[model samples]
Target: MYDRPYPGNLYIHEILNGHDVRAYNYFRMPAQVFTGLRDLLADRGVLRDTRFM
Candidate 1:
């Protein structure tokens, strides 16, 4: 995945040239929310390994 900065937000993409992307209002996002999502993804095998940065 990769991130790109915009005027007042950021976008994260799961693929470089595909449609799997999401826009983040980063300044308003809570860290726990991200962690929870990561954990869910790992549990469901959506992520290859249970690893996150």
Candidate 2:
């Protein structure tokens, strides 16, 4: 079902790297905080990176 060449993570990355307001509009949280939370989850094994993800 995942057909987009950019994929979700890449799109998120782009949003995070772009304007802070865009990230907030998309995630409802600041980019830095969101990134920190994501990293924490991944480091704690709460998030996993899959081929399709």
Q: Which runs of model 1 end up more than 4 angstroms from their true locations?
A: 1-28, 50-53
Top candidate on TM-score is 2
Model 2: lDDT equals: 0.87
Question: Against the correct fold, how does model 1 do in TM-score?
Answer: 0.39
CA lDDT scores, all candidates in order: 0.44, 0.87
Specify the poorest-scoring 10-residue window by lDDT in model 2. Answer: 1-10
Candidate 1: residue 8 Cα off by (Å) = 22
Clashing pairs in 2: none
The alpha-carbon RMSD values of the candidates against the true structure, listed in the order shown, are 10.5, 3.6
Best by lDDT: 2
Please give the lDDT score at residue 36 for candidate 2.
Answer: 94
